[model samples]
Target: MSLSTTSLRSPRVVVIGAGVGGLAAAALLARQGLDVRVIERGQQPGGKLSQLAVGPSLLDAGPTVLTMRWVFDALFERLGQSLDEQLSLRPCAVLARHAWGPEERLDLLADLEASVTAMADFAGPAQGQRYLAFCERAKEIYDTLEQPFLRSQRPTPWSLAWRVGMSRLPQLARISPFRTLWQELGRYFPDPRLRQLFGRYATYCGSSPFDAPATLMLVAHVEREAVWQIEGGMHRLAQSLAALCQRQGVQISYGREAREILLRQGRVCGVALDQDAPLQADAVLFNGDVDALRQGLLGQPLRQAMGGRPLTSARRSLSAVTWHLQAEVGGFPLSHHNVFFSDPADEGYRREFADIAAGRLPAAPSVYVCAQDRTGDPMPRHSGQAERLMCLVNAPATADARPLTEEELLLCQAQMFARLTQAGLKISPSVHPLQRTSPQDFARRFPATGGALYGQASRGWRASFQRPASTTRVPGLYLAGGSVHPGPGLPMAALSGQLAAEQICAALRSTRRWQPVAMPGGMSMR
Candidate 1:
């Protein structure tokens, strides 16, 4: 798996971006006795694991749930540290709440049996049994992919098949990579509402269920595994990682942008900063969106590093419009995570994707609201007090080319709140301090992305395999982040960092040829 030639001196590695991926890579490299430095443009760490201000409250503006904790545990364990000692996390009793209308609601509990019972009551005994069977299928798919696909380096279809071995090809085929998630859901649930609810998992990767492969059902199994809530917002997890990096002798330079990646004789040698002199390094790991390099935002020399690949707008992932506010809630008791579905007349979530595909805001988009101040309790800890809430709706990743107008944005906002009211969740109009973020804002925050939350849209089965590997065409340069191999989500992003670190360490530790031992499906050396 190693690529670089052995060097006599200790290697100096510079990571661009203080995201979870970058921070994770830096920590592992530092632990390996390498001199590691992280460059971040923001005032603080945590790229998308970020927060927004509302008076004295800092609401989580990016990812709200934490899953696949084992990823962090392994990272800390490798660094000779403990993840539990670093951050406090409480497992959620109620996974999420879904509402189809004022009187129709369902809560998926952490307990499988309890969730089945609840589903039976919501739909019917037969549908409930179907749900139970669906859970089993999801688990089967997850079990099959966890070791061979997720934990390994970038793998093509041929490599994945070879790793699975000839005996298990049927199991791989059953994962249903050829069908769309939305279509597959119809087989298990005759109830349209149930189909809509489960199909929504595709959005986790910033994709539409109608287009994303059915293989995405693994997301359901991931949540079923467990969802933990950070004691302080999710941003605290980022800060904790940054703290760990510093303790490991990794220097973090905040407020300094990486203007360009320095290359010498067709290989990476260092990073050029916008505010300071270039940093000389034996290797460079980029944890930001890959599009930034392809678009020449990081200098023209590395623009063709991706082989002048064209990332068309049609291929971009979904973006969102969000509202962060502190408001008093009344009807429809809240859970840690809640989703309010659009009426069936709105075409059962299909129109939402179609509108976005046409570069138009959805007229009746479903809404996801995160009650930051609530646990499993029916009411907020401080009853009647203004609770921190973040409401979001799916939108097109067209801010850079087809930005929404002020009038269009207002209409979109109005429709979002209306959907909430229809579900019987009421927020006091006298709410103090509400902030809104559009796709345009996101595009500016993460350049050359067009505001895509996930690196690229998981449009088909091949899409997952299409993500770039940790190693780049330029030697000594690597990639990490949601956009790279393994896919998006807090844990997946961290795993991508681990993959990059493993490759860098292997490459630097020796010049002897080594077979990839991380997993059977791991990438072979070039």
Candidate 2:
């Protein structure tokens, strides 16, 4: 049963969860000529990036905004291909429009000078100039940290300290790793409104502006560098990735739930399906939430390695409540992206996290709407015809705290409609519940997620390194996902997959001989 004694050669990798991370790993490994199989519990692949049908229109269930295009480009380049051939991406002229109050509105243009000009018009020229200064500082931080930190899988504290120490100590102060994102903004802009506008970037990863570190200002650099839209929808990117994986010879199994991780003599051997049939593999790469793997999905042996800590047992990132509307209104003078801020942004955030902890709903919540499709334009139809609208509000992930009561659903729907009306989108449309992925639902669908979209809450000082590493205590096993290193969002998830694949490749290159151990009675070692 020992992996070292096994006579097998050539590692066969079985990846559980065919989401972005899993697919990315599978594609990379398969390209490396390893036998790779991807199993997904959902009816289709793509995990959170999957598409849903809303009447005649299609909606992307996750990540409407596409940032950090280089991450995806590099992935394709690694396979000796071009992303432009696989999928067409349109550069967005207007990143997003933000509304602090009904009277106060600002548009973040893709053109830096145009954005500064717009800010000058809205706030003042001084504020506009300050914004330029702020962006310069953000760029400095991004340039100094992106390669050594974000693009790699080195998460050990000592590794971080060494890297920071090597890069002149004064540069660390310039990055503002100690101050809150809001506090940093305060130092740059004296206007409260201007601070609030830039502060919205914190929510990109579902953290509060008041709490997230100033280092998050790099998010602005990422968006301003290149904001893109897929030609059809964000889901098209997922579809393209899936197509690429298929072309690379990856075996994808949909609706096949993995019941356990089968181990032999303390090393990863294979996986057991829900039907009790065991599929043997030389190594296992988990693309799903690692916390779930450590809990019990892979059975007792994996759980024991985690010291009985439930992955969902920890505090999670913010959850969202989204509504997909198919309405009859055309030529709507709305941008591709929009954020309608509720009064007192901090209060709304406080309510969301508090409700998640206590199991309740926030009274007033900040809402975001995405009307743009793959073309960075609205859906084309007859003039005055209704268009599709995707509305989302930050909410607690725990269903027990934010139950889906009939009255509560009606209230939320009504509130959303009223807010939309106030924002100037006049439309009475048929609403279809394409999908309602709450924090509790996230835990159910992504067991290791603990209802957290980004795996762990990025609140503390060590939060950056708090992201799990690819290598685990169990030999021949690795992890890749938003919950792991590099953190969440589409770009980070893709990076995690690449890092995991690199680790696997490195392990194989050093070991040379691949070993597959036998399972006794076809049961998990748990």
Candidate 3:
């Protein structure tokens, strides 16, 4: 359900970060006539929606694929702008191209029938029918929770069961919360290869299929519903939203960090920024990881906002080692998205998870390559003489440790490229526009939290509610980002910001008239 927000009279809201959650909240609240100011420590608006440089070629460093387009469409629609009009997007015909080796390749296409045919050709008719059934169950999980859990402020299994009614409680069981995704996939896919392909969805949130909740299979249905490629790059999607925020009268300040969250009484008032005077406001929305709040990075007094539940390093999710490459390649027929699985004997998924559990990099990592320059056409595509590509190899959540040593980095890089070459994507080391990002690098990029990309992993059915809600123990404070409720992914983070804006609007509506809101200078958390 959408909030009926009326225009307000200059109530100030200071968003501490300019990431997707920050940008979305600011844009929507600005539309509600709130005086929104977005401050970022970086030069660009996007936090995780970052880009890498290879000579003149730039590749998207994070989130190469875009799915759940409706989330974005709704956000833009509320601002009186069409998402399609603001930016060009092409629907991907081939959702993903998967390969085990040179002779073993499968293309999951946009069309379900096409995919069924392809799967049948790859496996057999029985397997193809089972694939369709898998899609059905995946869709059921998404449809069951999309309303009560996904769109709500915060939800629990009890709340979800109540929403679904006692009669539909069996659907909850059907979601298989008790089983790991690997076990659940076995019921539908007897072939280990197919299981591996579908189970890879667990890593979408940086979790292992062997242990992640079976509910995560909903990801397959989510992506299969629709996928699009924004023009220019995924980073451009962030730029477009930032532009919309500016156009809607949001006061955006970059290169500024929030020194601390200001408080008046037990409630939030605004933020104190570095190198400038502290700006006061009615409330503050923290759009970074909740772990930052628990660590008292914002301020010790602000820890009260956490409502006593603190985040620990033990529950943090997975991290990665990514290579952004700009090069001219031959041989391998690259697609917009591709994956090269490691040896089957190693139980690639199990072995990799074990290595991460031990804080050691995987011996034979499953590599994901995104040829950013490649389009959906049958023939390969690129803008210039060379192409931009990126390969991501999963690694342990090691953002808190010392950056990998030279020897370790070399070994990881060697292991990654060797598998890539063996899987038919042969590229010379001389490839221009090459850069590598380690887990420690990610930690530095997004402070406090180790390089856990998806915040906390969705370990079980109960894991979803472990994240804090939009409204915290502190009356006027709010949480919005991947680290909070609704789980991780680009769309979920954007939705989180939207939910935060709605909550703030509701609270303000109860406290005052449409006149205005302000703060005092003498405010202190202590």
Candidate 4:
């Protein structure tokens, strides 16, 4: 059962979970001539990025907007392919619209000068200049940290120190890593409206701007770099990646849940499926929740260690309750993405995160609406003609025993509709609930404790290192995705997969005695 270095067998890589991370890792290893097998519990690939059928309209369940296009470009380039050849991406002129109250709207345009001018007109001239300055600082931080920390797997303190030292500490300090994002913005802009507007970026990683480090301002820079949407839907990107993996000679098994990480002696081994069959491998990369692995997918002896001192302590991020609506409305002044802010922004945010931490729901929650088919397309209606809408509200990630009652749903729906109507959206042609994913449902779907979208909350200075590394105490085990280093979002998760692949490749290369088995069409045998 031992896969010794001297053995003629090719390295077998078992990647659990068909998420972006798992798929990316499998594709990378397959390109390197490794025998890679992907096992997913779901009926199809793409964890959260999968598509959902709502009547005839196709809606993307996760990550509508795509940033960091270079990441995907690089991944495809590595495999001797171009992303353009596989899929088409359309650049959004208007990124998103933010509303403070009734008759108040601010559109974040793709053009920097236009956005700045809009801010000046809406808020003040000083706020506009401050935003420009913020963008510059964000670009600097992104450029300085991109290669050394973000692209690499297991960024040690020494590596970070060296990179920071090389960049000159003064420039690094200018990014304002000490203060919270909100605190830093407040320093630059006197207007409270401007601060609240920019503060919303913290939720990009499921964090509160009041608590996340000012370094997170890089999110704005990243977005400005390029904001795009897939031609058909975001899920098409996942489908393309999965297709690329299959074409590269990687084997994918759907609806096969990995029940255990079968270890031989104290080293790496393989995996056992729920069907009671063993799939052997030289290395095992888990793209599922790290907490699940630590909880013992193997059962028994594995269970003891799974609960043992966690490698990293994590604070769950805020969960959301999303309502997918199908309705008929004329003259809906909204793009693909829109946000409606409730009164007293700080009060609402505090109630959602802080009050929830103290065990309570927010008094007034900020609601976000994403209208996918606002352009008005004909055909495919439940009863008659209808459009698709995704309404989300920021809620606490507490696992309360109380289930959502029908009355609660009606009340929330009424409040959301009122807010939408007040914000200049005509919503009087009968709206039907196509689907509703609550905090409990998110928890069940993703198995994120308390349904926290982001793996851990980024609060204190130590929070950066709070993320677990790719490798664990168990020899062959490795982690990838939102839970691991570099954190969440589509781009970060993709980077995690690349990092894990690098680690696995490096580990195999170190064993010079092992030779890859040659097969036809650039494939390898295990």
Candidate 5:
């Protein structure tokens, strides 16, 4: 059921930011026969889902993993497009490889039984059995929340509980919102190595395992479902989305920054772009961090629109320091996704988070290295050529206030490389260009965020409920991004955008000029 384009007055929607959230919203709204325009400050599409130039190769600068691909598939399908037709995707067999020392390494394969057998070989029969049990529990948690929480429009605790019903209260309790992720992992893995490995899931949401809720374990299940390697790069997904939006009649203006969301009579009326005339719209969808509104980065009106609330630094999520390079490497075999862990014997894992919590860089941080070239191709494909790699470590989100000094970053780099060397992987120095992005760099890239990558940290159980929903106090202004509900990551952000679009269409249904029709399964243009 799509809205009639022949209607006298079509709803005009302006989406600020060309991030996945903004792109997704623009695409959907345009498909519904509404006039949609997307404005991005950057020259290209993809906000965090971007690429960096490293010498002759382009390395993925942000997220490398692509999970929950159905989110995109369904989105494209609704837009009368096929994701497979638009982009090439290769399934990844090896989910990731984790290393603690030179010889001590574990690989989690895409196959569940294979991962279980590998765990058994690495830890023992008991550990293997525990891994199986953990998988079951993780699956249960994912299934339990998939409909009531993830797919729902920013459900509160009470609403979510009601959706779960009285009969499933036991299942709700099993989610273990009261306990931290670190504390919950103990029930599944006695070995500290396994605990550390599993606890790393918290970092997916830019959170510390010691503070994040046990519900984060569902991330393990999400990964187990599937991981795909996009041909070219993950940024290709952004390109495809942008292309689709244009085809759907969405006007996407690159290198255009939205300075303010204009309001008339306390309702969104237009958007004021940097150094340009304002764009009149019936509704506005903001795809950047909600904190930007609270902090008055966009405009003073946005602060008042947000009711003058401030997001504390303590609630901010983890930032990252990344080194993207195209380099020759040797020693330990590299997988597409790899993790070099800090020594657990010396409590380095706990200390890492504690140091970040105190706004200090960890002495020895756990590093994540993404071998972009190795994802879909055979090892022989890059026999002699340089591999594009992105090495990242979690850091404090205080770079906006106190940027990391060159001396401090140099020392941190040395320490990070030392950990890589200890894991038996070595990089050959070359004339190839390397891009080092500090938390301050991220802060500059995305305004109003002190380099907090995934919005506010998923610290307490209430944190999920605290994220602002699509509908805000402002009548015609909505929020959609990683900072909002359904949590962070590419798929989650896309869902947030879809939710905002739905809300916009539903609200506009009350107007006399346009009547957008929604079908049982989706929205359509009549």
Candidate 6:
């Protein structure tokens, strides 16, 4: 349950990218008495978790909601830090507002009973019952996977089964890892709208509902457990964690890019930076997309470790076209989180999936709007001047050699706002200042990613297991971030960091070079 090793000097650990995963690993390893240094190319530490500015507006550029908060609690608790003390979080009363068309609107609430009541009123009594049952099923799947697949680092189904023990094998069927999430929803809700509603869970990992495994249903339970609105922006959480890392003696270097992963006899020894001299380290934890490692972006030598054939565009996840606007609100009352679904809902997703699959932007796409001003209440519009608002529409990955043209984007933008208006929501473009970020922009910012938002797409049934693991074949190299193991989203990304840290601790312990160290997530090494 503890790690022990003999060493006179502290082992220097270098983390690539200051994304949540890198920051988490750096913080935990530093706490364990390792000399940890984080390298980032950007001005801030959040990576994709950070905020962006469009003229006068500071908007959340990436993820908006914070769910599975316990993952963060466990992380900070390891360092004897309090998350509540460090950051201000407002629990979302209404998780998110969903609109299908002019007459159909639904709100998923933080309170499960309230959501069920809303569903009853929106759909029918039968749907309300089905929703309650779906919640139970979702929780069951979540409970079944929590300790084994999510928390533990296991490579194959056999390893996962071994960790779960023989008794828990039947529960695999309980989680229904065999079916697509969209197909599985048909069993719970007969309403196509409700099916698409719950099936939306697949998008949580940046995969299409028709393709992502039903195991993603756990996302529903994850959301129901907690959804907090970070007071300033989601990036504030990253800033807070970076500050804590500094307090723990972890050195953070920004505006410096990692050019190549220095290797010694097929094991990681250090990293070469773009702006500075090479940094020598006992081990390296990479927090960027594994694509960087495979594409030889770091170095040609590291490509073999990435495994598999070259990643094609077909393997990427759905990207998005985003709008960050400082505007005034009107029409339907805005909530903290609002999702405007495409009317003739089937028409929206069908075209979207087909277009993205064919590597083209969807003409009509579902839009997710985050009204930053309306966190707990609808802000009174004074002269229609409100703070920042973020509008996001799912798009194909940045696969085209040429960017999504302003012409193409203009068309998508027209559909985006149009869907909002048809769904009882309205925003005046003339009154607002907007910044558009196409998938091409995302790809440019995060290199080698086709602007695929949530790491790799979780496509086939085996994809859940196919993601790169924390412990790789390379002895001193490790992987973290949403793309690895436990899968995407804020909490999942943090867990990936914890897992990488645990592996590093275990590796150091086995080498007999460090003192006995107890791992995170209540895990202990023998």
Reference-based lDDT, each prediction? 0.87, 0.72, 0.82, 0.73, 0.87, 0.81
- After aligning candidate 2 to the native by TM-score, how far in Å is the CA of 251 from where it should be? 0.9
**lDDT per residue (tens digit) for residues 280-364 in model 4:** 8888998976766555545445545444442232366767777775677644466677787766445554455565454344446
Of candidates 6 and 4, the better by lDDT: 6
TM-score: the better of candidates 4 and 5: 5
lDDT of 3 by residue, 66-146 (tens): 999998988888787899999999989888988888889998888999999999999888988999999999999998888
Candidate 3 has an lDDT of 0.82
Structural similarity to truth (TM-score) of each candidate:
0.95, 0.90, 0.94, 0.91, 0.96, 0.94
In candidate 4, the residue pairs with backbone N, CA or C atoms under 3 Å apart (3 or more residues apart, or in different chains) clash, namely 294-306
Clashing pairs in 5: 1-524, 2-524, 2-525, 2-526, 3-525, 3-526
- lDDT of candidate 2? 0.72
| Shift of residue 228 alpha carbon in model 3, Å | 0.6
- The stretch of ten residues in a row with the least summed lDDT in candidate 3 is 517-526
* Residue-wise C-alpha lDDT for candidate 1, range 1-526, written one tens digit per residue: 1135455556788999999999999987877667889999988889999989988789999999899999888887767778889889888888899998889999988899989999899888887789888999999899888888898988889999888889988889999999999999999988888888998999999999999999999999999899999999899999999998998899999999999998777788788888768998888999999989888888888886556574778899999999999898888888989999987664757888899999889999899999998885433365777888999999999988899899998999999999999999998743466899999999998999998899899998899899889988888889999989888899999999989988887777565432223433232222
* Candidate 1 vs 2: which has more lDDT: 1
Looking at model 1, report the run of 10 residues with the lowest lDDT sum.
515-524
Give the Cα error of residue 462 in candidate 3, in Å: 1.3
Deviation from native of the Cα of residue 195 in model 6, angstroms:
1.5
Model 5: per-residue Cα lDDT over 101-156, one tens digit each: 98899988888888899999999988999999999999999988988898888888
Relative to the true structure, candidate 6 reaches a TM of 0.94
**lDDT score, residue 223, model 4?**
87
Measured by TM-score, the strongest candidate is 5
Q: What is candidate 3's TM-score against the reference? A: 0.94
Better of 2 and 3 by lDDT: 3
